[model samples]
Target: MGPYSGSKSYSGGEIMGLKVFFSVLAVSVAISGCAKSPPPAPNHLIMLTETADGQADASFMEVDTLEECESRASAAKKVFPMAKIKYIRHYCTHTNIKFEPFLHNPEPEGPSYVFGLNFVKDGKVLSKVSNFKSMTDCENKGKQVCVISYQNIVPGE
Candidate 1:
C-alpha cells in the first residue's frame, strides 16, 4: 500500500505489539505520577551574637549552617575596628533541639517558672505559651515537641 493511504489493516502480531507498547507507556506514566519527593534534609541552626561583657545590648543573627555563622561572627568582630568587644558567642545546634524557645525569645516574661511549646509546623516555627504547674504537667499536654523556660521580666533603668 502507498504511504498515507486509508486502506491499511494491522496483522495479529502488529496489533499485539501496539498493545504492549501502550501498556508499558501507561505503567510508566502511572508510576511517575505517583512518585513522591524525598523529604527535606536535616538542618542546623547557628546563633551568632555580639555583646559587651557578654550581657548588654547584644545583637544576633540566625543562619542555617555553621560555616556561615562563623563567617558572620568574624565579620561582626571587625565592626568596631578601634573599639574593644567584650564577648562574641556563636552557637550551632540541631533544628530539633528543645531549646528553640530560648533561641527565639532570649528574654521571656515570667516571674514564675513556665513551660513553652516550640514546634515546627508547615515550615514555620511556632511558639505556644502556657503556665504549667510542673514539668510533668507540661509534658502531659500531649504535644510531641515541647520546650520549657523560666522567664523573669527584668525592670529596665
Candidate 2:
C-alpha cells in the first residue's frame, strides 16, 4: 500500500489460504528432500572380430587358425555337437544391433560391432578390428608383414 494501490488489511480468508499454500509447499520440499535410490549403471558391451597374419584384417580373419579367432567357437560347437559354425559364429556382435547385414532388409540404426581379437587359445594375435572408433588405431597400417593387403579392411569384414 505504498501509494501504488488501495490500502488493505489482512483478511481471515486470505491468511488461511496463504497458510494452506505454505503448508503444502513445506510438505512437498520435505518429501522431496528424502534420499532417493540412484539409477542402475549401464552394461558394458563386448564385440567379436577376426584377425589374420598378426595384423588386424577382417578378410584375413576368415583365414585365421581355428584356435586363433574365436575363444567360444569350440564351446558353441560342443553345445550343438554337429554345428559347423567356423565362420558362422566367427561373426558376432556384442548386442543384437550388429546382425543387420545378414538380414534381407537391414534397419538404418543397425547395431554396430566394436571388437579386437587375439587368439586366446593359440596365444597369437592375428588381427584386431572394432567399433568405427578403434578401426584407425587397430587397422593394419604397416607394410612389415601384412597377411592380407592393407586395403582389404572393411566394416565387419
Per-residue CA lDDT of candidate 2, range 33-140, in tens? 985743222111122223422333222222123343255444544654353222223332222122122221212133333334433212223234333334444355
Name the regions of candidate 2 deviating beyond 4 angstroms: 42-157
Residue 8 in model 2: lDDT: 73
lDDT of each: 0.46, 0.36
**Best-matching candidate per lDDT:** 1
Q: How many backbone clashes are present in model 1?
A: 0
Residue 64 C-alpha lDDT in model 1: 65
Name the runs in model 1 displaced over 4 angstroms.
1-6, 38-107, 110-143, 147-157
Task: Please provide TM-scores, in order, for all candidate models, with all chains considered together.
Answer: 0.34, 0.24
**Model 1 / residue 68 / CA error / Å:** 5.8
Residue 137 of model 2: what lDDT? Answer: 41
Q: What's model 2's lDDT at 30?
A: 92
